[model samples]
Target: MLKPTIISLLMASQLVFSQKKPATTYKYGYNGMELIVKNNKETIIVSTFNSKKAIKDEIALKIYDMYTKKLFVNGDLLTISGNEAKVIGKVSIRKKGNLVLLDFYYDEIQWKTGLVEAYED
Candidate 1:
């Protein structure tokens, strides 16, 4: 009985700590332009390739939400095609008054090909 009770408690805690499911999703031709909806009330989209019309935009997207009382983790999204092998660091994408600033880190890297276009789905 005690073992089952402990298992149930662990499962409940796991659910409480899991990341919230995305309320809505964005399908875009860019790898890092996923529409970020916060509080289910605000939708934020960073311009791809410094332009909202930039299709086939290649980018590097960092995801993290670690935070403390004073320190907030930064999840920066950047487009790689802007430099096309010229810029080895994070690049800025500004368009339609939207800006996605980035900082490059070489400590750890992972490449994915989930490029998409900006649109609600």
Candidate 2:
């Protein structure tokens, strides 16, 4: 009888805790994300005007490391460890006729992907 009550109480506690745990999320758009993740005892922001964009006529990739406070480019599936967090991802750009495609994949925390159908604007 006591064992059964203890088991039920433990299961209830587990359910309550699991239901109350907060979820991490990101605001995805052309303007980029302000705070991609703010959990796991660390914070990671975009820290840039634009993480993915097209300049002139070519696709330019710029990844900002909040930990190092440095900018990287043309990093295909690159990985880096920041002062606060670690980043591993890539942004691929392809041109199909008059339309351009941009695939953005950031990290395990969140992804900032975009599909733009613009030439060079």
Candidate 3:
């Protein structure tokens, strides 16, 4: 009886200490663009972004151009990282009439994709 009780206590301690917690998610949106950050721990964080702008803002246009050049021409995945998080992902661009849409994916699970209305520049 004492041996069985000891074994059960050890098993409970192991179960409590060996479990990993799920990651926390955060999101930010600006001018039809959305950014997501997932933090699994203090050292491991991932980020992804999606943009579907009307080409109205200069900053948005510049970011779109950079992503287009990098993803389409270089065939490379974009890396967006900071002091708190690090993200490596792919960008997909599509055009419908005059509007351009950008979709970013940081894994098979986290991503966003769509189209937006176009505006005269």
List lDDT for all candidates, in order.
0.33, 0.39, 0.41
Sorted by lDDT (best first), the order is 3, 2, 1
Cα displacement (Å) at residue 52, model 1: 12
- Cα misplacement distance, residue 9 of candidate 3 (Å): 36
- Residue 99 C-alpha lDDT in model 2: 37
Best by lDDT: 3
Give the winner by lDDT: 2 or 3. 3
For residue 94, what is the lDDT in candidate 1? 29
* Model 1: lDDT to the true structure: 0.33
In terms of lDDT, the poorest run of 10 residues in model 3 is: 112-121
Model 3 residue 73 CA deviation (Å) reads: 4.2
Off by over 4 Å in 3: 1-65, 68-75, 108-121
Q: Which residue runs of candidate 2 sit more than 4 Å off their true CA positions? A: 16-22, 28-81, 88-104, 107-121
Error of 2 at 18 (Å): 5.2
lDDT tens per residue, model 1, 1-121: 8999999999999998895533222343223453342344333343333223322223232211211121223443333343322112233322233433332322111222322223342
1-121 per-residue lDDT for model 2 (tens digits): 9999999999999998787334343344144433343455544344322233322111212343322333433335655343333334564444455433334454322123322221121
The alpha-carbon RMSD values of the candidates against the true structure, listed in the order shown, are 15.5, 14.2, 14.6
What's the residue-level lDDT of 86 in candidate 3? Answer: 39
